[model samples]
Target: MLSYGKADVRNASHLALSNPLSKCAESTSSDLATSKLHTIIDALAFRARSIPDQTAFVHLVDGEVIEQAITYRELWSRSQSIAAYLKAFEPNGKRAVLLLDTGIEYVSWLFGLFHAGMTIIPAFPPIGSRGLSRLALICADAQPDIIVADARFSNARERLNDLLPSAMPQPYWVETTIPTGGPDCTGVGPARDDIALLQYTSGSTSTPKGVILTHANLVSNCENASLWMGDIRGRVGCTWLPPYHDMGLMGGILQPVYDGFSTLLINPGHFIQKPFRWLSAVSRYKVTVTIAPNFALDLCTDGISDAERSTLDLRHVRAIYCGAEPVRSRTIERFTDRFAAAGLDPATIGPCYGLAEATVLVAGKPVDKPFVSFHVDREMLSRGTIQVVDENAPGACPLVSSGRPAAGVEILIVDPLELQIVPEGRIGEIWVKGDNVGTGYWRNAVASSETFGGTLPEVDGQFLRTGDLGALLEGELIVTGRLKDLIIVSGRNLYPQDIELTVEETDSRIRPNGCVAVALDDGERERIAIVAEIKRSEKLDDVAQELLRRSLTAAIVAAYGVKPEHIHLATPGTIPRTTSGKVRRRAVRDALLAGNFAQYGGRTRAPVPADRSAS
Candidate 1:
């Protein structure tokens, strides 16, 4: 158990000072800002050649253990075969959509794509049928030359065929089951300026946007990430995040590969079912480096047993990157304290910052560096002023600094409307300009133009406008809030508007215009929840609740399919409303938690008359 009073003071004190690990105010010169494409694949191939019989990856399945160790010679030979096999389809072998679920095959194909001189578009297999369909739609729109998939997702090709009326004469499916060496086909890769990977954000909207990343962009981010993660070669990096997410695909897996290190991966579903297995894996594998969103740590702290904890050791983990969502101080403390006895180092918990648009990392600090924070007035924070204060000061909420920008990246805090750079300690939208920044979104010219076509008046350059709200406190980035209605639950972005629209369509009693979708932050944790008004009668309420629950649940499961943390039912017209008649979600949440819902006594609440014509 944590003493909030004590933790609050300590946390607040840390926030009042500058981050020790923050980089100097002086920026790197243009001449010093540099990158090399194909470093990761090249490094892996180099290692495979230098040490032919090294363990490359270890995979564990139900009661079965399998390890694939490749010598440099073997990896090179197989990559050539895989590349040759990949060239059987496209005349130019320009690009391929890799749908292989996580496995050795996936890793090999990823490596082979580099050797084959083909761009890779990775999609998660079990991202729900709807997510898969959405991916196919985007892939069709992008018009990749070939589709590489495991046998299980062969149906996706059919789905792709249905979604894209004019896909092509025939899209090729490179089965990863065959361990044929990577294709030996030789073709000059597109310029570093050309697209290397296309990653789609979770299907937040009907038509998902694809983040277009160039080879130079990804390679640069990976190299910077390696520096932030320290020299990881010859170390085992453990991971359980899904291989499709930017943080997982690029940061978790690719960073290790970039550093020429072997990785131990477990499927996310298996870990979710048994969160403790994550710790078990770390101890069993002696993983020296790993990364996870804050929630995974929360799960381990909440569910791991002291008895089981005693049997494990996480000391080898030099740094665990906490990102992919808002970094909360409570989460960090809880995890550190809980695992302290298990040889987990509290200082090794590195709270970093990143986004999909940045190819994952925008800012990070060394793990051994003490966490930094700043306490400012929430009201002042919203007004764009970052006034640091004592932790015990009334109305002071501590904000954790996401450290300074990564080595080569430049971050600016600017007013959203004016594009004027805000002064130090003033909150503003985060604008990032760097080689690691993506080219633009796939087929989303409108969005791309809006996000990347802006010039910061103070910075005097183009920057990718991040919708996130933050500030620069003594040169370190302190993210405070988001300007959008994106709900982040357990490190995944959940759009409330999407869920509200889903519910409104199917539930008749859900006053379409009277629903408020908001995340409830109950001091300790946050979750996506909603409140909606219905008829004010016991029978009506019961009927509405059950129908709304079942219908909304099924609809959400079918569509985006993530289960919201909770749902709330309110009496018709009782939910808080704005002057213009818009539902006030924050107010509704305040009222619901306060138990201020009104009792129903109107006509809608009265029982129907039962008497027939005078008997």
Candidate 2:
């Protein structure tokens, strides 16, 4: 069995309400009051009115700072002008596509559309030429009457127009000041059921579906989330999540604005190229709330230099929500330890769970409690049993619970086929139905009917079927794996993460963090292939490869009674990841299929020599 360090003498009990600092509420009064229309608009206008002179947005582009802050009265007046301008351009509540990155213009553009009662299609600005082509097709499908773009997107707009000049309508660029001669508009919008924004999903190629979020849906989610976060309105937050994403759009912008909170919004490119800037902004602004995925923590810890650490102080960060991907226990521990020297609170790193379908949040632990991890057997876990094991067991990886469902939401584990509820601690497909559940996708009836509609069973008068596989243990939701991510091999199921984790812990020679487990097909038999990243300059060549193969074989044989087809060693950081930090395993598998490892700077060497193989 593999060895492990002893557990520290820290407390892991359930957070008590008696602890004034604890934010977890076992029994919250489920009074999710609807946010009055007048109150919400008044609140937004109030911020501008109160701080009309203060800065609303500060842009640091190409090493230059451009500031724009409008008072409430000025913002309202400008919005009226823009609304009039837009109505003159396209009368009625026609659609307006926004092709701009996150900036002051983005806000004005949205406010103008809202003011005009027109649908807003938020397109990612940095999508460039290729993304623009895809976006044009999406627009064709959306068939928007008009488009609003900034100067930066002129090239993309021209390219899209060139590609489909006849089909695609002409777009109006918002370059000069807000317009003045259009229909006069004011007051609360259409009914709460009217669509406010059409958020497009990621899979735009095979099936492009935009979620239709109503005013009530958006308002309810923000109000509920505000209740969850203790509605600390007026607090300052720093965000770098892309505006196109649900998390960035709803959580980063809508939630803050609805609750009257001030936030420092940064673009995604800034975060990807230099993650330190994200942290620097938080430290500089003394931000109290921030959210990011798991890989962001890994990048921050791996990329930050020692010299940069001296200027960092994270003491003011009260709560950090981590979701969008699997929450790695080891990664968080290392990150917390690294920042602890700068007075960062380990308890503030709140591991959360949610998805786009559920409006971005399902459950999360209290901010005051440090993360909790359950050590379970990897083999038994794949069999739908969460077999608790000793923390130091050789094949044990701690599974983090995403806490209980939020107030006004109910989540349950059920059999995907049978539709019957599963017992506690037994893995099953997760099914949820609540006010937080979103309306069906835009125009894709087949997909919407199959996934979000009532094809699945109902729970307490609400439709269900989450597509996630998890179990409930001790009254908390423990997501084990994805129902669709299981790989069928030789009449058995193998989880890629289980094998990848095994490889990382089996041998010390392999790059600890850069390893992936993928299945390889030889046109006859399918076998598992372990692609591990080796530290450069670790010369052994074939010897290192053989050692990895043998070590992985022993570990698998002892744990799952299986052997891999091959063990390939690669350079560190070769695996591609999504914008939100999820490892793009299919990309690596495709590279292996096309035999492009060598071209990709990977070592094309054979396995280790027989004699050099590990015992």
Candidate 3:
């Protein structure tokens, strides 16, 4: 059980601060900072010749059973053949949308598109007929010259045509899958500034925007992450994150190829269905590094049984990079404690911060290092400043550090209202400048300029406005909340995450990661509204719900000193999340205002109808 406690892991610098296997910072053989290679594909070509037989990727059929182990030469050759096939359509510098499932085909075709010098658009195929609108939106915006798919999705044209923008021409369709040991063909050599691919944001906040990453940007991010995380080669990494996302693409897929190493791949479905398979893979393949969202840590810690846990060894996992959501301090401590019997290192849980705009990693540390944290005066933290305090201090809230900036990356904490750099330990919007930062959104010049062209009056340089609220304490980045999601009551800035965490700890039936706290308009007054999901395993009766609602309201008041105007308890899976598994708090607020929760849950007393005056 996840217990909300006052204590947590602090600055445990006693843990190994360095990876002995690695060389000094930025000097590793695969370090692109000091290499002549401009693009990742260039590095791949070199490795393909020097170490042709090296294992590049291993695919898990069911997250544990190995389905295929693709070699460097095999992948290189496959990319070449696919590139040759693409050339028949004059694919040079044209957009090709890859709508494929998670497998070797996805990886092969991804590299193939780059080799063909075609601007790649990485997107997931629709599930049945669902999600076509979003795909159509992306496709319409991209105006792809060709659509590449696996053989199974050959009928995409019929379905996509109806959804595509009327003015755009129908994209040419190519349905082909590569076979092993295909005859090779020559591929194009791309320059550093050549457009490599476009990765669309998961759209947790608004419409999905494609972040344009060039050949240089992709290569730089790989090396920058490697510099911060220590050596990349001679170590096994694994990932079950959707391969198309920035984290999985750069960290899981491209990093190994850049360093001439092998990484295990698991279908996201497999990991979700059987969380134990992750630990099993770590034990079986001796995986040293892996990446996942914050929820996966709690899922694995609770989902794995003592009997099942005993059959595995996790000593090999050096770092489990946890990000893509608010990194809970309790989760890191709970996971480390639960697997202590199985040789899980306390330092293995590394909480990092990133976004699609920055090409995934903005700040991370050596995986071998422990995640640092600070217990601050909760009220001061909300008022755009930090006051470090003892854990036992009254009204103390613990915030986990998401490490420091990567090599060649500069982070500036700027006051959004003042338009100046805030003093350290003061909360502000996180602004970033680095090679890894994408150029701009695809074809959206206005949005691009606002996001990527920010500059301070005193400091001159291009900075990407991260739209995230965070502070720097002793040089470590402590992300507090989203700027747009900051909720204020009585002039106090209350982060929704803080309020939501308090609600989860209020009752045993409240699902972990199933609660969202938002501010709703109540006439001229703004009110705090909490929508939480009850676990399906628990019985939900009117009598039980009434008791639970009281507890939830009381808990919110006790924690935040503000009364929740309404508490609605819903069935499991009532809340919405993005494709990347981030809770859509904005969507939750929208649903609440739209009266969507009325159909899903039993609320406390007669619920207050949302005041549509603010809506």
For all predicted structures, in order, the TM-scores are 0.73, 0.81, 0.92
Residue-by-residue lDDT tens digits, candidate 1, 1-615:
101011112222342252111111121212122433354455555555544455455544421133333333555566667767756654333767778655556666777786667777777663556566666666666677777776787766666676665725556776665545344476733455667688776543224567888778887897677666654433667777777778878865666545555666677777767888777767656677777776677678767888889878788777787777667676677889998888988777877888778888999866468777776664454345788888787656567778888878888888887768778887678999988888788878989988877685445667888787788877788876665654655555444544665676667556534456676665555555666666433346455456666677677666553665555666666866421123455665555555555533232222111221100
Q: Write the per-residue lDDT of candidate 2 for residues 232-275, one digit (tens) a residue.
A: 63355667787767788777877665655556677777787887
- Give one clash count per candidate, in the order shown: 22, 7, 0
Q: Any runs in candidate 2 off by more than 4 Å, and if so which? A: 1-35, 38-43, 46-78, 89-93, 126-130, 162-177, 180-183, 187-190, 204-208, 231-234, 455-458, 490-493, 501-526, 529-561, 566-599, 602-615
Which should have the higher TM-score, number 2 or number 3? 3
Query: Residue 359 in model 2: shift from native, Å?
Result: 2.1
TM-score of 3: 0.92
RMSD of each: 13.9, 9.8, 7.8
State the lDDT of candidate 3 residue by residue for 331-386, as single tens digits: 88888898999998888888888888888889975567788988999878768799
The TM-score of candidate 2 is 0.81
State the weakest 10-residue window (summed lDDT) of model 2: 15-24
Worst 10 residues of 1 by lDDT: 1-10
